[model samples]
Target: MQTSNDIRTPAEIYDELFVPALFQQWAAVVLDAAKINPSSKVLDVACGTGVLALAAAGRVGTGGKVSALDASPEMLGVARRKSVRIEWHEGVAESLPFEDNTFDAVVSQFGIMFFRDRIAALKEMMRVLRRGGSLAVAVCDSLDHSPGYSTFAKLLERLFGTPVADAFRAPFVLGNPETLLSLCNDAGIENAQVRQHSGQVRFASIASLVSTERACAWTLGGMLDDQQFEELSREAELALQPFAGENGDIAFEMPALIITAHRP
Candidate 1:
């Protein structure tokens, strides 16, 4: 169950496993939702490993600028190695370091759920947007909506306990569309549009899926020890087998609620 990966930090695990499995594809979706274009100044808040920021940089080309911020120096360190074109800042979502009207577009992919004050963060994102600019945010859809994770949650509950399952369910906290809309309204975001977009999750194998989740602090980290992870991996082989393809790859629908708003 344990391997050389056990020594790696959560951010390293996230950048190596979770980003490719879950986040990389969504980066393009977020940038597209924000309508990123050449010459646009962009900021990616809570940018883990600079996936979205790096994509925005390529989309904007040399004519534009991309800056990314996250609270974790560990995560920023991983992101910094990926590209020098982006301005990586270590900061919290609730208080951005940039000045007002600084960016043509601002985005956060799967980071809103952990913010201490969601409304404050939203306001800060809006405050940094130029007029006619856009803000696009993505949060996981409810666990119920994601069939793979729904079953995984049940599996965790049966095997580990409700507390362990609940930790896995934390990312889906803001999955409700109405609740997300209400939060945007409370933040005074104008003309916000919330839409559900289906995304794909892939892992080399069921054990790969379970092990990566074990390493992710955003999910099962600290909740599982070596024995627990080994047990979960054994069970996941059978529990998550339905998602396995002929080649033994695991794939599932991991949808997200994308909220987009344009400043008038």
Candidate 2:
């Protein structure tokens, strides 16, 4: 599974598939545990497009600072354009560019699951947090609970083949609570609480969804050439036929996990 950073031009990748509502959905989870305050210093790891970082900045107020880091230069570029106050930097989760006890809170949204070295990344997150500081992260649950993706995945597998579907499932690593908890424990984070939440992932239309997937180039990247792309698109349209309503509107349920922990 390729991490978001590993994908070429992650910033554009996000802007395409990750709609504004999706950000709001995940931000609610991240903010709930973030406990942002006027004096808090925040760090957002793998801060794609600065969604969480921007939300954190608003919560922390002008007195506080937010450092948004990502391995992809393109991602940082998008994040930079969003806000000048955010200290955007190019860095990986395994080796964050920050001092120990530097931040009052550390957060990530849909990022922890993609780290090549999950344990190392969590430890690094712990290292940067001040004593008793909180760590809040949002990750997707398994595809079973994620209706939109699950259906899309099944269709892709049946039509485009299993390999194409496998690529999409790669990034959803922490879809299980036990697996997530084990990773946290390995990183020395204890007493973590996991919460389940549901959000609506709306698509303008089936064509729009397919177009966005093509633009992101994560799941379908390299796997599909021109011919395959057209075939997959047609297959997806057929699969989505059942979901189409009178107005041609389609929405999918996106279930996510909000995992929060406090540094000892």
Best by TM-score: 1
Tell me how many residue pairs clash in candidate 1.
Answer: 0
Write model 2 residue lDDT over 9-35, tens digit each, in one string: 645756655645366667756876878
Native-to-model Cα distance after best TM-score fit, residue 120 in candidate 2, in Å? 0.5
Query: Which regions of candidate 1 deviate over 4 angstroms?
Result: none
lDDT of each: 0.92, 0.80
How much does each candidate deviate from the true structure in C-alpha RMSD?
Answer: 1.0, 4.1
Q: In model 2, which regions exceed 4 Å deviation? A: 1-10
lDDT of candidate 1 over 92-115, digit per residue (tens): 999999999999999999999999
